[model samples]
Target: MGRRLIVGTTIDRVDDKSLTENSAAANRTSLWGGRFAGGPSEALARLSVSVQFDWRLAPYDIAGSRAHARVLAGAGLLDPEELGRILAALDDLEAACASGTFRPTVDDEDVHTALERGLLERLGSLGGKLRAGRSRNDQVATDLRLYLRDHARGVAARLVELAEALVEQAGRHVDTAAPGMTHLQHAQPVTFGHWLLAHVQPLLRDLERLRDWDHRTAVSPLGAGALAGSGLPLDPGAVSKELGFRTSFANSMDAVADRDFVAEFLFVTAMIGVHLSRLGEEVVLWTSQEFGWVELDDAFATGSSIMPQKKNADIAELARGKSGRLVGGLVAVLTMLKGLPMTYDRDMQEDKEPAFDAVDTLELLLPALAGMISTMTVRVDRLVAAAPVGFSLATEVADWLVRKGVPFRDAHEITGKLVALCAARDCALDEVSDADLATVSEHLDPSVRDVLSVRSALAARITPGSTGPGPVADQLATAADQLTTWRNWTAESVVPR
Candidate 1:
């Protein structure tokens, strides 16, 4: 029976007889096949195969090969012609990968195995020298770091796009009053822009985590071969420089074993998911008939199959749902690495799928979320109408009393009684008569009516980062500057194609 491999868009079947007949069979079997009498069991092959998902690492693997070939030439392991030939073969492999002409065969267990076969097919015996001082353990670790380092910058850029959308929307609504809530009950009057900027602040922190994570991920692990330092005097630093890494591993064991970088990346991504989910929940609420605070654009929304009037916020709903998958990815990596011993294990192979999943998930999510936010129509009239209801101006009333020389505790009591009176009369605090207010407390002078309006309530919150127009305007400017700085950083740091 033959093993069926999926190479790019084609399926290749390599029989046992063909495996023995082909000179490159050893490349497909195991990089170390001297002791094995036969190929891997069908079950083992099925369990070990990762070329399906890890094929995305092909470019990084090729990049590492090019650098490794140079290091080999420097170490006197390969002649100049051999190094040049190897680099050329790697370049060809990368092109084939890009064109979707090269793919993994079923017998190719992982990307390293698949590429090695491609190299050997291209260079005959000369390609064999490329693996001299490298091991799959080190190769994969280096490739993952390279992959993540590039994608982290991409994620950073996308996050900035999202933040930019928020800031733009906030700028438009700085003067539009909205009801702010605590425990889902109206607690204060705030500008709609303030609420939007709150989401931006957390995204800024997520960007910081990504920048910090990138610093840690920039260390290369190429010279750590199968849990030990390479025996050859090859310069790992040379490979690190070639691959855009800022540094090389200090300890070989730690180099191959450390998946902390992947976990950290996942954690940051999960935190991003959580933050986006919170915003998504708000979007879901705001678009509802009861809230009526915003409406999703037709492009970002979908119609329910059976309902003629249905405009479902499917994008926001998906953003909320996908957050669980992001958290699950982080948890999966942590659990897989928890009991593994020092150095590399087969279990480490499980790391890429979750990490890659988180990346793919966010890559799809962030841009759509940005578009949803950028195009949505904010119902400023509805927000303004709701902002002053539910006794949201109670806090301002208390503050007015405090300004009248009443202690805050007494002021709170007076405001509470006013709120109670309004509730009993089924009226708004502002609708309460001056006589009724004075009966509640002598502090309730005519000046008390000054802060009763929602506009006045928003204006009274003049502290930094408050919901007042001035503070929110300051926040909007700060957000714009911060986003610009991050955008510049992303453009400067992005990995070249």
Candidate 2:
């Protein structure tokens, strides 16, 4: 028997028996069954199927199919009636898939196969015409791109929400001081607002990365047939436009083979995970009794089963742990693509799970992280109390000495000796006598004690981006404005799309 396919307004026929025989000898499915004497082995079918994870791409696949049907009609391949019927069938299939009434069957090899089966069931022989001049290779590649583009916008929106939460919390704590650390030891005094704003900056960068990734991912691959350009007169540009893609692929071989977008997205998500993990670590530490800086809301925390007094930071810990998983997702995709040759390969099927899991993990993580941060209780008094401890004012002492015309190296030595005196006497730098201060350096006069107070120490840092009240206020205002811009952008650019 022979089968005919529409190619660029012309009909191309093939000897189905020979093609099927060849494909079956290779243990392919009925979609290429004419030459096949048998289906794939059970183990191979199980191994090759991707419907389990790729089924989430069902809507994108249907969108691509609708566009392809229009192009086919424009090429004079599908009549108006057939095109309308195909589109209607796809709409019905999409509804069923969304409602959970329809799902992939055991024999459905992948999302494409499942949807093709659904279309066939809906339109009977008419559904068979829909596959003309298209290959699963091109179809899947296009669908994955569409899926990522759409979800990347969604992720951006969620990130904006988290950023808003951080900014709001920062505004609430603008005057609340805390001990800032370097190498896990107290280094300086900083407002709680400054600490929170520190996290917001990285999140803004994460949003930028997502936007860049989306820009590169907006190209379509719909007309790349297998590993070569499609034989049909179907317009890849038209399909790209219909699917909201910015451009069509320039090379069919690269179009089908390239997965750099997936890798980039994974990298962006992994970066998001890394940022969140840092924030989570802070939450974990602040909630500890030793720090006593913040308390997690009961709703966002968990109690231990065996320990009666335990209220654990499970959400933050999970956010931290899931960061590793996100990195693993990036590595998995990179490894999968590293050895593949030109064009499509079976290994590409492994790409969906890692990418999908990355999305799932971040989507699950962001809301929880936002809620945890928003609802947590801040111990402002405790923070202020700890802010000036551990000789955090030592730098202020050095700066005061430098202002008094002492060499900076001498000022540093004077401050280090004063810190040692305070340590030996179990007192603060402010408690040192004026006579004791003179022993360190004559520049450390009684008047230098003015900088020992936490408020004075913070006030002295009036430089831009410093923790001074004026600088922090400026930072907070800038953060608020930037956050408003991002939120507006997300609402206008991402949400509607």
Candidate 3:
């Protein structure tokens, strides 16, 4: 199937519906309506509904319910027959939900409320037993964790795919020389492979971040019971194990209240965004007329509507632009979390939208970027030709002088002056007359010409992890190994395909 982002949201104009009907199904939205004499006002219903976005959590919620049902069965809240029927009904409802045959109604308040309504319809009064010793507070917390944990696995998978693309490109360009830049000016000669591997380092760290995030996220909040321990003997550990969590939470209030996982997830996603933006910025620059170091594949580039000659790097531009949205998601979740007191609050419902939006952004972006990186043509000739521009070999001159017992400061000054002399004479560094080299500095000799070539400059950077071709080849090997390890982790993370 073609890649797409599927989300449930109320960010746009909402669908208008009448909530005035007094039916029990419509009123089922307000689980707390038991305390009120009358149902909520239509205005409140319209403003308060979260099924619009939270419905995306339905599958996770159902999974939690399945686990919770087993816990309830263990607690003897229901007999064996009731447990079997509820489990069977949950399976049917899950399939219906996944196939889109089942959906949240207009009056369903949130994912928890909507799923409960579905349960009630499926098993009648028997479904109400499953709600024993549980509340939406803990249910939502558990469900969100399940949802993000699963998606994080998928994110890690897609991220590794992007890294693989970079590694493959780096392999192709391992011997291709390019100008490594500082302050937008060529600073040194480097293999394009080395520069590409530099981008992969941060992505490897991102994979580690996701792997670590899973550790903290694996504690289940399912039995927290509306911010207090359940009076019933629910086996939270059993439920946690059944739901694939490493452990059950120790504190009920903290379990429901803690949103550290979400905020951390936002930060992780934002960091990935920032990294991709940097890669995107380079793509934009390299594909431009001024750089001409890269050419986008026809499949990836778009034609400008007004400018017929333009083949725009829209994927790169969007990747760069959407980073702000990812950062904004982090900010949104953090800000919403800042003022909340202990336990779950309505404010936290807003968390899913931002979190979901970022996942949507990355899901669409990573594959497109991977394809772009894999297919786009690297202009090796342009890269090699530009490697020595802007007195790029001046550093080589300074380093050569340093080897000849010249102080680096004095050598720097001599190289600077030589560069100026070349600029004034409108010539290459090697093109300078021997007398000019003699006049510029006594340190300058005919042998300085030996270090002026791009190949020599590339070979001179021999330190570990330097832009030298050997280190770059090693870097690609290291990156490929890291990508392999992460690929194994995602495969075991148990996220549905």
Highest lDDT among the candidates is held by which one?
A: 3
Runs in model 3 with CA error above 4 Å? 1-29, 495-497
Q: Which regions in candidate 2 have their CA more than 4 angstroms from the true location?
A: 1-29, 492-497
- The better candidate by TM-score, 1 or 2, is 1
Q: Arrange candidates by lDDT, highest first: which order?
A: 3, 1, 2
- Screening candidate 3 with a backbone cut-off below 3 angstroms (N, C-alpha, C), the clashing residue pairs are none
lDDT of 3 by residue, 1-497 (tens): 11111223422112335222336554454477667798788898888888776777777787788888888888888889999999999999877776666667676777777678778888998988888989988999988888888788778889999999999999999889999899988888889998888889989999999989999899999899999879999999988887778999999999999999999999999999999999999999999999999999999999987999999999999999999999999999999999999988889888888888888889889999999999999999999999999889999999999999999999999999999999998999999989999999998989899999999988887788988888888888888988999998877743221
Local distance difference test, per candidate?
0.85, 0.82, 0.86
Worst 10 residues of 2 by lDDT: 2-11
Looking at model 3, which ten-residue stretch has the lowest summed lDDT? Answer: 1-10
TM-score of each: 0.94, 0.92, 0.94
lDDT of 1 by residue, 230-347 (tens): 8899999988877777889999999999999999999999999999999999999999999999989999999977998999888889999999999999999999999999988899
**Total residue pair clashes for candidate 3:** 0
Residue-level lDDT for 373 in candidate 1: 96
Predicted candidate 2 versus true structure: per-residue lDDT over 1-497, tens digit per residue: 11111011011111122111122222222456678796788898878766766777877788888888999999999989888888888888877877666666666677788788788878887988888888999898898887777777667778888888887888888778899999989999998988898999899999889878888988889998888887789899988877777899999999999999999999999999999999999899999999988988899999988998999998999989999999999999999999999989989998888888887788778999889888988999899989988888889989998998889999888889888888999998888898998887777789987877888887777899887778888988887787677666555331111
